[model samples]
Target: MNWYQTWNNPLKNLLWWLVIIGMLGSLPLAYMRHETETSTKNVEFVFDYRDLLDIADLQTNPQKFVQDQLGKMKAAGIGSMAVYESTLAEFKESRRIDLYNSRDAAALTQTFGDPSENFTYLLFTNNEAQQKLEPLIQKTFADLGVGVKPWSFKNRSGLVIQMSPDDAAIKAMDPDPIAMQMLKDQGFQLVVRLSNHREFKSNDMDRLLKQLHDLGVKRIIVDGNEVPGYTEENTEENLNKMADLLNKYGMGLAAIELLKEPQKGFSTLAKQTNYNVVRLHSFTEKDGDKLTEPLKKSELEGRIQGVADRFVLAVKDRNIRMVFINGHAVKSLDRAKVVDPLSAYYESLTGTDGAIPRIEKFGFDLGPAQPFEVHTTSWQKVARVFLLIGGLSLVVLMLSFFIPEGTLIFFVLGLIGLVGVHVLSANLYAQGLALMTAISAPSVAVMLAIRTVRSGASAKWKSGIGFGLWLLLRTSLISLIGIVYEVALLNHITYSLVLQQFRGVGLLHLLPIAIAGLYLLFFSENNTYSEKLANIRRILSSYISVLWIVIAGVGLAAVYYYLSRTGNEGQASTVEKLFRSYLENTMGVRPRTKEFLVAHPIFVLGGYLAVRYRHAVYLLFIGVVGQLSLVDTFAHLHTPLHISLLRIFYGLVIGAILGLILCAAWEIVARSWKRWAKPQLLK
Candidate 1:
């Protein structure tokens, strides 16, 4: 039959109409679900040149490469870069590091040979040693090269010098003015980073300021320079000197790790200074530049969140501007491994108006009187959800009473109950548990309902198996639907926020399946044991001896399982990534796959099959199978909530399409079976 004929058939036509209605209706939901990429552009990015390449890569055209990478960094939302006095290559070239006492050369050697290894700085820890060795190194470098000038003092907790290399060695040893100018032209803020080494006390400070001023740097980050708990009596001279330096250079200061002791003094400084404070928190202490793996699900995001919380408090209390820098994938492929999770966590912690991101965009708006709050739950939103649930419940009840749609009423009631359960829960995981109850409760009800009606009926054991698989398919679909609505419209579910929803759900979800099985065996209908052969014998006799068909089904199921496991199975994979990337590139956001492909199809197919094959107990079995799929899908709470909702939408679309095909094929099989089996099976 063609389109007209198919439409004339009630089952096929209703299935199509359901698909059309679901897809069309979902368009609005998808639109509402669409999200904008939250910008972290306010973040100041740090680049220790040694993190990118070693002395070897800097042999030729290194500045060109470094400049290109900096361009990429700016494009990727880094607002500022910090300049230290020395890098490994510059140290190695100075020819003075060799004259000093031997230290661990591992950091320098690792970067030299491996182009991929460079995510950390070679932190020379001996400030005392460096202070003593500085003059010798400076004198040695001045004599070693022609026209070599040491631009000195205070960086990385040691005394070091930035050398102006001779014309011939410029590309190999020093920063090019042209490339530095390009960075400035690109609007990249340059900050001179210094430490509290003793050599920076007097004449060295003046030289440092003049050098920075000439380099177009207007910001400075000084560590340990300000006296802790600085009071008028002890720090009067230091404060005067700092003010003079700030005024003369027209530069701002960057403070870090200054909140712990004498907080009130820092608070006083925060009001008067334009310094930006960064909190010290390392995600990884690994050597070299490769990013460590992302935070695992087991380690509740308290480490990061704790730091952010404390940082926010200090910043607000002090009225200071703050910036967040990462310890993982700061600049490389798979940057989102850390960046996105942090962004999502901060959003939850601080909401859309997060102080950190706000500081990045607008800078230090916290007045002396203003207090910062991470986020507050909108009671208005909660009320809206409550009102919607009540209104929708009433509508469903009205439709159920007027139309006498038992299954629709039951399912709609189940959905409304899910929302109530989710809203009443403490968090996303609890909400998911409530949703599972919703998926299973109706499923158990349907199974019990089927048992009551089909208690006196009978069927071939082979048909019973098909019916079981069919019920599995149905429950999975319903479970998927609940998850989608719960995730997208209700909760901001993500891996960082919620634990896996599979706990306790699997057993409860499976209990319904077991109950369905019992109903099939005892209450409903099934082939009885023969005089010599039992339920097994009848099914063997009834099922056609198509070895090829059995093999084909196994192969198809295996292929589907493998593909599903690898592709869009539950977790985001390469396929999901590529598709999401395309969507994000084109549409700025992506939806999940299981929505259209897995769960939605199961719902349409399972419901229609349950309706058509009510007497055979087929749909319930398939719906049960579907419930398993749905459970497995939710087992992956590692996915973002929006993506999960998208998956359900995709599943519904695919399920409806395939449901049409399955219905058409089963129609022929049903007719043939009527002739071969007892007419009572049809009833």
Candidate 2:
């Protein structure tokens, strides 16, 4: 036995006490988080007005089609309409204006086309359109060094632009005030869309925003990858100006979920506005088409249901409070008709067990999403200091397993480094400490489980089940402390809203298992560190075999496969997805498959058999997966706290049950082997 194993090891006791203190200190922060999450339960459903116009343009009477769709959407509980900045092409599609090229204009007048002057012409549909658009067009074009002049087409007022049709088509125009007023009058909230295509001056932005604010617009979603004020010429300075205007108008931004990268100026704007942002999930036109392509009735219904399922997950699990839905017209060759998924989308929201009702059942109601009111308190900072020391202790505890005599040395150095990091960058310190705790707690838990199993190596069947269950509970509790420290340390609204993430997830996933494996091979089985080194040297000096090479290759492949399944982009098979859906429907929270099906079962049965067969200690390496997964579950900061808690509970209860079954089955197999197969093989 090592001197550190003595009962009076003061350093060991101090580390454990710090871990306990850290866990207790984090409880208040957890309660505060619960308060923050429950305060915002309103979910907004937004329809893409541009998408509606595009689909309407496909109909025989575009005006009638749009009115019908808007009424249907309002009936289907769409509370908001997302209106984009207009282009000339979009205006033509909306039937607000008619466009003619130079040749067409010349032909209409029965005059030859001018060889040197190719110009674009626009004819308003009515006097109202002419009054609203003509001056706006003239000023916009005049500012861009393009000439605009009054013209007449028969009895209608029109404008002539010196630029060609293509150039005129792409120019930026403000969102149509007529449409905005109509939608607002129709009882729809407007979510204005902004683009940075045109250079925005402070005064221009202020004017545009003031007009929208007067029309009762409360939120803006960007039209492209960059926010409205983000440009190559000026970065965050422009964002600050935009944020000031948004804040002045009492408006917020809708942060889109799962973008490949965040909008360039999003963080600056969000921070400047005190994080007046709500998470939005958008299902694009292409996504709708993918679900309905080669559309069979049964297939369409199933896929639509799939969309409802996703919306529910987004609201009830992730903190997505706004859903932006887009659709396109599809040509149905089988029926000889053009169709859009608008009705189908309506069904997904209004069906008996659809997203709306499901989300409401989870305590969300249909309304504008409220942003998190993040007000920091003095106590949270004090609590984090405790959490930091606890995290440092966990790192030292795990190190003690490998370097038994260096516990005090490691803890002192870790303390100094953590304090330095915290002073330099609190965010960096939080993430680093969170990662250390995440890796250390799981590795320490698995090591403790191995030691417990070793001490009970001579236990009988009567004690095995109870002993294994106790170990499972104890090890999980240790791993859960890592989660507590992680949550408390990084418990800012930015993490809850996913504006910042817990870094080093890849390292967190890999290190615990590797450490547990190292402990299993060298530190367990009553061997000293020097003796373990001798065994390694003796094995290296021995002959290399083909079987060993094959085993090494297989191990490397297994590691590769494990890593591929770790992050958000992990791939899953069709059958697995179906099985997951089944579990989600049947169980309120689906336990992770790796936990209940694989790791927990092995841990349980391995605990039982390790007493009888020393070789079974190796199973604890695989068992470390369940422990680390418990910690990793909370790393998804966007998932609701209660949902994460429920998920963890389900995983533990289900995993424990499955593990006992494996133990029972193994007992039966071993008895049968002893009775017949083992004796025969011995002969």
Candidate 3:
């Protein structure tokens, strides 16, 4: 005989294989799809721009600034750029001179007419234009002591110069007319800087515009950092006022404020005015020297991407034509003449002809650029845990099949293993484990029972009795174990010694009755016992299915009820009313009962059936009566009842009608199955 012939037939084997494979594949797919879809729908992204600004501030040191900025940008989901050596000494001195004089002056007077004649200028229009002006501005400002304050001159000539310490001295010396003429001869345009800290007056703003027009200041870049206590409304009003003045004077306002709180309003203004504003921070910056320890590139990318996303959203439709990203955002350059890679990426995304326009870079130090990628290896750890559990279950199952005595041992071990898994998975995979155990345990028990009973030596009454008793014992034990594990153990009930004592006492009373019942059932009838056992199995299966459906339906209904009742109006007071009505109809006597009956006719009729047919279908009728009593009790609690005694009696009558429906469904399924399975024909 072939090895396969010793076991199941070809058809049985094929059917078993198909069922197993289909269930295994389908269940995982269903569960995975549901989880994925739920997570995708529910997960939300929250962006905070302030945190990015703080991170950029922390990257003050040139060496670690780029790496630190990058790290923060990834974490905060925003991008920034910090321009290095952009502010020249002459610019700062001019600002201070204006600030000190404007605070006390009577009227706007030109201390130095055409101040642009004393400064170097560079205009950024196109790449070719920038290259052509770069060398010209560099040579013109070199060896020429632009007497202002401590200022460093670099390759770029649109110098962001600092404040002059000796403003009075420069005014006294009157700065050689020829040198002043040399600045004018070089086509220089002085861009005056304004501090946000200065209190704005309507008259002073008018004077400032006139002064800018006299000095040939074509653009005024406002320092956002200096702006104190500027609210959204204040900033908008100030910018609009400045825009009006600048429009009158044929000059434009360039903003360099912290793109933090007032960005939305600023963007709105930018859109309305068609003014382009450049951010002065990089994507990320870091501390510590690279030679000793380097920050993770993956971490930095995440930070940069976050900032970039925010920047894109904030100015996507703004009038801002371009953003000059700070070079320090990518890497630190000592010479302050290198381009930043992150700046280039921003430009690529939000510049002219780019995916998103109005972003560029004023690179102090730009370097080699790399492609962006996100790291998602955290999920691997969770996957490993699931794989381990599955592998262990398979190993135990396979081992059990190979060993004869091992079957029972392994069954016990599997139960223990599942208990351990339940405890462990509750923290890691609670719902998945719950669903797995719910489906697996019952299926496994049924399969094991069928296999054990089918291979029996004889279809004797003793065997049938033994099988039924064993099944009952197994079910009872499992239930007890479940209660202990789920409720007692979980609740910190550590009375194992007391439980053992109780079990010992209970066994004395239970053993004899159980033995006698087993013997009686065993000796009754072999064929009848088997038939009845099969029927009982079918009934049990149906009952379990029905119970599960009831549980799920009731649970869902309860959730809906809770949600519906929770908003503003307060929860419905149904539970108390139903309870009170149940007691009134069921326990009240004579006249009191008559009054209750007259008010609830359905309940009265149901009570009559429960009292009269207290045998065959009374249990079924009682269930219906109980349900109606609950509803009536809740109603009574919620509102004062104004019905007549006859109406009460009529409500009980309605309950009786529903009781009849319940009995009909029950009998139909029971009788239908019985008629279909004729034991005599099978015999």
Q: Which residue pairs of candidate 2 clash?
A: none
What tens-digit string does per-residue lDDT give for candidate 2 at 1-683?
46544532678878899888978878788777777777788999999999999889889998999999899999888999999888788879878899999989988888898878779988999988888878778877887999888888789999999999998998997888889999999999999999888887899889999999999988989878888888888777888899999999999988898888988888889899998999999999988886556767888888878888888888888899999999989888977888788888888898856788878877889998889766456688688778877788888889988886777778878889999998999899989998899999999999988876666643644677776777788899999989988888878888888889788888888899889987776776677778999987887898889999999999999888877777788778888888987887677578888888888888877777776775677776688999999999899988878888888888888888998998989889989999999999999
Worst window of 10 by summed lDDT in candidate 2: 1-10
In order, the Cα lDDT scores of the candidates are 0.41, 0.85, 0.33
TM-score order, best first, reads 2, 1, 3
lDDT (tens digit, per residue) of candidate 3 on 217-267: 454444454332235457767666755665677664444323444422334
Q: Largest TM-score belongs to which candidate?
A: 2
lDDT of 1: 0.41
TM values, all candidates: 0.39, 0.96, 0.22
Q: Model 3, residue 69: displacement in angstroms?
A: 20
Decide which is better by TM-score, 2 or 3.
2
Candidates sorted by lDDT, best first: 2, 1, 3
- Model 1: lowest-lDDT 10 consecutive positions: 367-376
